[model samples]
Target: MNAPPYLSIVGWARNDGYTPNYAKRLEHSIGFLVRQLDRHRIPSEVIVVEWNPPPGSPLLADQMNGFLGGTSHASVRFIVVPPQFHRGPRGWQKRGMHVNNAANVGFRRARGRFVTPKALDTFYSDKLVSTIGRLDLDDRRVYRCDRLDARMEAESWLDLADDELLAALARHVVLRNGRLTHSIDWKMRDLHTNACGDFILMSTPRWHEIRGYQKDPTVLCLDSDSIALHAAAAHGASEVHWQEECIYKVVHGNTHAQRVATIWKDWQLKLDHYLILRHRRELAMNLRVWLNYPRRRVRGLEEILAPSIERHFVAKAARYAKNDTSLVTNDADWGLARESLSDRTVVRAAWDTP
Candidate 1:
């Protein structure tokens, strides 16, 4: 039997107000993701759907159509969905939902056998590529990585200054394994919930079989991965945990307390409420103490120490930004580091389009 032709990697681009450096940061992040695919030698094409394009802005769909018309990825053809065909519910203002919808649009347009819905911010390992290779199409299993919070100490990188830059550098380093000796591990064996959309990989046929994301736009905090996993599970699809160190770098400058507070506020407003699902599945299973702890303790820490962490990150970013010749940028050392790490041969495959 012939191997699948391509891997449809679906992602989103935001039109929200961005800093001057936003495009560079986004490029690096997207580049990192693409590098992982390159590492696997996977012939893949990316679909970047836009949620809310600025008025008179070139249509994202047109951009995609142009890309598909021009670029070639072996058997894969990159394309973008026209905005006219893209529509979802309204009232929920969270970016996640918008991304989820955009991803679904990519999914519908994919002509490959396998469709991988990936977060633009996350990176992959050789292990992920190998794991996806073993999937049985008939079984339609959804694979999820045990997520490692890639939040590192800002001072680790010597080139960034300012809290934002430090936080960003710390995130980059952690995602790239700048610190920590061993990879963190997580398991969903006992959890009765779905996988995070950040890195969920599934077959294309199965994705369409489920009818894609709900059309109701009012659903906040709910996304394609949550809905897809649930649908797949209901269809008797099995779930497996790939416990390799897949890092998810959350680029937020808030503490756990702040995150909790944000979730609460968002939930109350009915804007984008879905933390309860996460709590029941991943957080409740692992960070039970933090979840069940008294509100007073959580609030106290948020008030007392969050400022310190923020300050440290700011200082670190500032310091690093001033020094471009930091040790972290030495490519020779990075090459050596890759060589010293355990040798795991990761093969990249083309996105499977049927």
Candidate 2:
């Protein structure tokens, strides 16, 4: 049998066209990745988790095959998390992508020594790929890098030369030196949580030990990525910020942009509200301790008083954001490991190169 690959690249997307020319962006990013892996001779496998796919639309697997003209030198797998698993917490209606959950699905099934979860619309620099290819990364560290936002038209992306593309990407550095000043609460100490879901690399074993991302279904879509990073830190994985390497993200979706803008706009109001909630939660915990409440009563009170807060709330709390203790939120069956999902080997090389 063939050995497990050196790296596993996992990401999730559906064909809802969340961004204009979403398919084209996926094609460009995935094509770039395959080419880079082959050029570096990096033994890597790519896993694209098509989570909660829209019905009646063509499958992303088939679309990706068509994107590469049904061929690629590097190994690629398309794992489908069918519509049935799209339901939200407590029977809440299915909303947009369950970003963390989908990532967990791909991470669980990844067969590589080192696993990196990324977005389909982001392209990795050759330097970054080469660094990973060297395979000298320390297993005890979690690697992160800044995301440079490049506003490249999806359809026009394929026409750019490598030199022109990299030059254009260098002009827009969204998160510099691991700082997104306005993205998180000012009271909270900053860590490299900016566009983290786009590129978070660690050993496959470390990822499993952290139990993937927080599985809470109600945590706002934007905050979960940072929560995962905080959880990693809590699990005693040292942070290694890649100042030299960058992941260029193609700016297209308004969801993330708008969310950040809204937060920044109402920053003070949200901070006050979060403070109020935190006080109540702390009061309840103290009351429980003072009264020596029964375990069941304590749990009930805890559930009532301490609701889950946003990413910034975690940033302010050391229990989850620092090394006091390990934080493994998910159970042993994380990433829907028990489910019998469809895993397809979608693209196999039919040509020399793209």
On residues 43-120, what C-alpha lDDT tens digit does candidate 1 reach at each position?
Answer: 565555454554565543443332212222323233333333334444333322255455656667655567767665
lDDT of 2 by residue, 137-182 (tens): 8888889998777765445655676656767677754534354664
How well does candidate 2 match the true structure in TM-score terms? 0.78
TM-score to native of every candidate shown = 0.53, 0.78
| Span of ten consecutive residues with least summed lDDT in model 2 | 293-302
TM-score of 1: 0.53
CA lDDT of each candidate? 0.43, 0.69
Off by over 4 Å in 2: 66-73, 90-94, 161-163, 171-177, 180-190, 253-255, 260-317, 348-354
Which stretches of candidate 1 lie above 4 Å from their native place?
Answer: 1-4, 18-20, 56-88, 92-97, 130-139, 152-195, 219-224, 253-354
